[model samples]
Target: MGCDGGTIPKRHELVKGPKKVEKVDKNAELAAKWKYCALSQEKLRRPIVACELGKLYNKDAIIEYLLDKSAERPNTDAVTHIRGTKDIKELNLTDNPEWQGERRSAKGDRYEDIHCGMFICPVVGLEMNGKHRFCYLQTCGCVFSDRALKEVKTEICHKCGDPFQNTDIVVLNGTKEEVEKLREKMEERRRAKAKTKKSKKSKAAESASTPSEAKDDTEVDEVRNGSLENGDESSQSDKAGSSGASRLSSSFNGGVPNLATSKRSIQEMEEKSEAFKSIFTTHSSAKRTKDQTSNWVTHTPYHF
Candidate 1:
């Protein structure tokens, strides 16, 4: 049978003696006649198998051949009364799952040995050149192999219908939980990077503004000091001019020469004071000092 519709609760009749399940190939029977199934005459002896599938795989139309062989598969089962192949189906499980109604999860991997229908395969390890893979399917049930688990990780199995999940579990099928965790990790990394970038931008802005702000404060302080100095100097000049005018007025009244030039002199003083007012500007201290030191000779007449 077919386990198609409902759970049939089918029971496998237990047999007290070894039963024979005849597969299609007479050659297999000839080669494996010396060995018997575990439930057969020899359960304790070294397991014997006739790897015929490896021989037929190279042909271009392998599916057609598989279908034809599958017809023989049932007959083999009926004759030998053995369970089906184990978890070593080759096709993608979702598609082409059954080649002539044989499941990869069938009890035996009777079909996996076919590699272009090559010669009989060895029962031992078969790994790729890169040491990344080794076979441990129904043809070989995680048996006497070096680093059996390692082999399963990289190899395909006939029992579980999927690549071996190391020797321990064959179907370690990809789960939704793992995929979700990976997505969460990626999102977390993205958020952390964004936070770091934002903080760096803020720090850069602060650093860039600090010097400009300091320079502005220095300029404002210098301007205020210059204004204060100008006020003091202007008051002193005004007082001196008033005293000179008063002296001129008294001297003229007390028999000195009629000094009409006093008024003109006071006007000239006012004009000079206005001109000097502009010189009290808030020049940058460094520029002012550089000019004064470099042009000391040019300022001799004015300074004196």
Candidate 2:
């Protein structure tokens, strides 16, 4: 009998049941990774690009992120390492021959294949869906499956015939070990390139600093000619001064001055001046004979 007013609880509220495990949709996740931009989460279109981590993105989305990095976006951490356009490479994708895009399944035909891929490997008939492991060549931007490459065992691209190395093949959405191997190869190549650039810069600097041997020879010749001309000028000045003194003596006293006496006086004056002493050795110091005080003139009218 219902005596008091009470609410009847539903079976879900009254009875505790096991927690429901979140069901992960595999198809949606695969579509998001293969057909959408990694950075902007938009549908992948033409002019697609990929990073070193093998994530696909639209070129326009990367450009917008680079132009204004401060803008808020859903996937900021995914593209923080991308500094410029050089950080990414434009992908050269081959469309699947069977892919109809909006044409094949627009009317929801029951006969249309749901497993058809938008892109396919030219080397093998395998599709690029999540069911198979795929990789792309960084050097040539050609996509292929890991199985096709291993089975064919060729160093040249099957699609374009471009030669490629082991390091150039980068697996898309690869395992941890595969990504690590790719990273090491990329670092090694960059280091080698930097070393070559540094060597070229050093060579350029050395070439710019060193002068030619011809220039050195011309500089030495100029210095020798300058010293010879200075010696000639000094000798001419000494002769002119001596001649003037002798002419004044002959006019005033009717006698010519002694040449040796005039020469000794001029030498003493030159020794007192530092400029003459710097140019030549003093006459008194150079003489081998004893000092002759009687021949020397202590006082002279000409100060120079």
Candidate 3:
């Protein structure tokens, strides 16, 4: 079935061999997860931060993203949940004394330390090159080898002396089971916090909305205060009038009359008047009109 034309090729020329499988470098992949920032895909630098989901990132890159949210970035989905600086904790990483950094590769030796790590556990001196399990404390963000933590068994942090629980120790580049456990813990903590906040808000609302009984008590106190003030003012004015009358009588009569004698004289004069009535009741100071007198006569016996 091959082409019969003059320019046609043979069957062997058209046939192709099976495709070659690509080799994956395990060392490079491990290094990428351990040494590179998950968000920017760059080498992890000082002041590194980790999110609630346990993903590592450079602090500077996170700050830049926070400052300008609208700016286009290829890895926007990686840190969408990071709303502010509070969402991430700055890592307190320990420097590896053996790590020569970029200069070590430039030496071009016959053999290279491919497994060399940039950080080591402060307690047990284990290299964190993805060979052994590593965990970081959520309280202090200090990293340590998993063996060091299990062997030592202390509630306090080995690096910073900060107290931490088992839940706070998040495994770095952990297995699927470990990651799922951490996710469950995170959700539980968030739910508890939300419940407490809701309860506090409800309590505050109840306190602010006072009952009608309280309002009525306040109004009664105001009315009582008003009556007391009026009584005090009337007593003060009466004292002032009595003092003025005494001064006038002393000026006109060449001497002031005795206090008891003046009070008795005033009472007698009021009693003699046709308009006089009980001292507590209203009385007319002037003579009444004929119409009023006639009405009074018809109503009852007029008593002064």
Candidate 4:
């Protein structure tokens, strides 16, 4: 069939072919992964953190997400694994001296380098612009290029000098296989921590369950035995006589001890001087008869 205006029909326009797969720009993908946050998709600022899966994020973005997970966000899937601050580690990044940041070109005259990274490896001086593989130590949170670690070969962190094992190294923006391995390690660590907590709680419970009364009784028995061994026979006899009197008084008035009659009054002590005895309110000299005593009203509105 031909057009109404006598235009020639093309065979290419008549037959529709399969849709071509749209390819993402490599530079933009690199910038998104290395320069921007994985969760917020904003520029990665200071105090950057990474999850167990090695996805980079701005610390504030992660905090905001954790504070309200139910809130509407564009990238909730990227942060579903992060339950709290403990799930992520704040990175100790080394600044790239060559990177002038956003202040370099305001007039647009100077050529801006898009691949330039804000941070660099402390050991090998490699830029962290997604061009090279980078990893951060879980123990120290120090970032270092993969080449530096493989070349140097040390158990200690190159930046922070803290000791770390191979398992502690988590790849940044890692492949699917690497992420899977990291997740396994994370699960293992969590399981180990839970076991330790349960063991500690059990130990605490066992300690709490021990009878404290038995210890108190043993201490009392030791004290009594020590007193019996130290004192003479005459003192022991006097103590026994006092104990028999206290027992007889306790039997008369249930099991409660009659402290008033069992203990001597301070005012009636034979060794106390009359001056000292007069200071006490219970002394006979301090007593007032009914006629001498006034009404015990502390305060009254009516005056006599």
Q: Report the number of the highest-lDDT candidate.
A: 4
* lDDT per residue as tens, model 3, 1-304: 6565767786668998787899989999889878998877889988888877777889999999999999987688978878899878887877789998887555566677878999899999989899998888889899889999999999999888999998888888777787677778877987998999999999988877766668889999989998999999999999999999888667667453555555554435533554344442234433456665764355543454
Clashing pairs in 4: none
Off by over 4 Å in 2: 1-23, 104-114, 212-304
- TM-score per candidate, in order? 0.25, 0.63, 0.65, 0.68
Candidate lDDT (C-alpha), each:
0.39, 0.78, 0.81, 0.87
Off by over 4 Å in 4: 1-6, 106-111, 213-304
Candidate 2: which pairs clash?
none
Q: Runs in model 1 with CA error above 4 Å? A: 1-192, 246-254, 258-304
Write candidate 1's Cα lDDT for 1-304 as tens digits.
5657875653454335566785687445322322232122222122223121211011122333334544433123312321233212322111111222223455565755322111111233332111222222433443222344443345554334445443232211113564355345435755898899999999999999998999999999999999999999999999999999998787677444454653443233443555454443322221344444555455523231
lDDT of 2 by residue, 81-176 (tens): 677887688877878888877765466566766567788887787887777888888888888888999999999998888999987777887677
Q: Give the TM-score of candidate 3.
A: 0.65
lDDT of 4 at 17: 88
Better of 3 and 4 by TM-score: 4
> Residue 262's C-alpha lDDT in candidate 3?
57
RMSD from true fold, candidate 1: 22.5
RMSD of each: 22.5, 15.9, 14.4, 13.0
